[model samples]
Target: MVCVANTTGRAVRMPRPGGPGGRLLLAGHTGEDPAPEGPDGTVAIAPHSCSWWAI
Candidate 1:
């Protein structure tokens, strides 16, 4: 599992989750899952918020 936090004010998008480049799951605080990855192969994160996914 992974948790990604966007500290900046602007929203962000990233590649779909998996593989070696991800942080391991935290002990708690799995934020809500965003909408599914877009066809362009990315997930959206709201500004100054967090999201999580299984690696």
Candidate 2:
């Protein structure tokens, strides 16, 4: 799993192991923890809590 942020005006691409069939999960400023199950281990990126980004 990979994570990318476009805070800047640049385009970024994350590589996946299983190619096109791979699944990507994006989590925003939510305070919930992600489930720990997937075909491979799940990948979590920028897992910020709602309170953290409020500031």
Candidate 3:
């Protein structure tokens, strides 16, 4: 899951309930390409921004 903060433009990494090595499933973004890679190979977004996702 990606959490964004609108004002700070920072991304919040939420703790996984299952502990370490948890998996986050991301769906495709319509009208846009896949998320760009980040430091941890996960997509990064600004804090409090609008969330676009799929189940």
Total clashes for model 2: 0
Candidate 2, residues 1-55, lDDT tens digits: the string is 5433334333223333245455435444443433333455443333332111110
Find the candidate with the highest lDDT and give its number: 1
Better of 1 and 2 by TM-score: 1
State TM-scores per candidate. Answer: 0.62, 0.25, 0.29
Instruction: Pick the TM-score winner.
Output: 1
Every candidate's lDDT: 0.61, 0.36, 0.40
- What's each prediction's clash count? 0, 0, 7
Q: Residue 12 in candidate 2 has what lDDT?
A: 28
Residues 1-55, model 3: lDDT tens digits:
5422234545544333133443434332322223455455455444545443422
Superposed by TM-score, candidate 2 places the C-alpha of residue 11 at a distance from the truth, in angstroms, of: 8.4
Question: Candidate 3 at residue 47, lDDT?
Answer: 52
Order of candidate numbers by lDDT, starting with the best:
1, 3, 2
The clash tally of candidate 3 reads 7
* Error in Å for residue 8 of model 1: 1.3
List runs of model 2 lying over 4 Å from the truth: 9-18, 30-55
